[model samples]
Target: MKPPTVFMGEMTNREVEAFLVDHQTVIVPTGSTEQHGPHGPLLTDVFVPQEVARRVAPRVGALVAPSINYGLSYPHVGFTGVVNLRIPTFMAVVEDVAASLATAGFTRIVFLNGHYDNTYAIAYACANAADRLPAGVRAFPINYWDGMTADEAGEFFGPTTGLHANRGETSAVMAINPDLVDLDHANAELPPFPAVTNAPAVHTAFFFSTPGSVHRASQSGTWGDAREASVAYGERYLSVVADATVRMLDDVERTFGAMPAR
Candidate 1:
């Protein structure tokens, strides 16, 4: 039998409503256009999640929404090519998107996020939108990496695992888009941070643009070793993350039924 078609941006109105009517779950790919060390692509943050969504949407019989390629990346501004949305602006955009989908009758809206900085903002947007949505219309935001188990983490990043451009991320990108990676420039380095820090670290919208203190702290903006990254390992990691995400969505659907009639 043929696989269920995942809707893309080019889908017609009838096709969209049909998919919604048949499968209430809609997956939205969220990522950032930021620097990812010397070898990885600037869009690495978005590419992984997008690829995962593309692979899983068909299996779960869900429609794929156009990706929100920009995210909150103020911390990586100094590295160049890193574009980020202000916290408030990002929150507003997410809220508006969720509200619009809820209004259109999508009961289960799943946000498949790739960027770490957008986590808090996305969470806030989901909560705020849920409050405004009619009963049963649930908006869920998930950090893809958070779905990984400790065992999986260990498997991906043995010991040296820094937050920014870590081994797991580099490996995943290499597996997904090997051509984009410039192995010659790949370097492993981790920046030092204070023992304690508060949320939002810095409030400036463009603090990532600073050198030394910003992304340059790491020689190549890479936090972990990329030498261990392999295509096979990446495929396994992607499968595990996608499976966990599907299970989470199933749990959410069971917890919240269809939306109430207007």
Candidate 2:
């Protein structure tokens, strides 16, 4: 017999009801539609977490829920084909999604995040929805990047490159589809001017945190160099993230026990 479907989208209402018989967990992957430099696809944020969630759910005995494709990504909005929701709007959406899952009887709703900008919004939204959740039903978010070690991430992205459309991310996109990324046209970029320096004026980490900072800092829309990105590294990154996510989900299950009967 074929293995059971892992994606909720592919399951019918009855299938989902059947799943709930033994499973209370569901992975909701969230990503953004933003420019990821010239080499990376606009959906780079979408693809990464979706892949990791799928890779993780079977091991964790969870189903992968449909993803949230838009996010609070104003920083990359200046580029072509970018769409960003206002912070309040994104938070509202996140809360609604979580609340919906809770109502649907999914006791453990995990928002697996792929975008940097969606971090606070997801966390705050989940927390905000807590009052509405039925007792024992829980919803929360986790960044996929957090699954990797600093040293491991540093290996793929290098120290100077922030998480943007850089080596690590581009490689991930390549792993999903090599044709989607154009290595020949790829460029190595860094924050211009004082951003590259240790000047006290520029707090290096938050330099690109401001809205529209990505556009103002680099015309190519890349926060770091894509020159070093490789499909090999992408596959490895995916494997590492997948394994780590499995362990993380294990911890989540152990930490939060069972949900009440819905």
Q: In order, what is each prediction's RMSD in angstroms?
A: 4.4, 3.6
lDDT of 1 by residue, 151-229 (tens): 8767655435655556667777778977877777777776554454442454233244342345645556777776566
Off by over 4 Å in 1: 1-4, 157-159, 193-216, 254-262
Model 1 clash pairs are 77-208, 77-209, 78-208, 78-209
Q: TM-score of each candidate? A: 0.83, 0.89
Give the range where candidate 1 is weakest over 10 consecutive residues by summed lDDT.
203-212
lDDT of 2 at 161: 73
* Residue lDDT tens for model 2, 179-247: 999898888777765434665346435543577777887888877788988889899989998887877
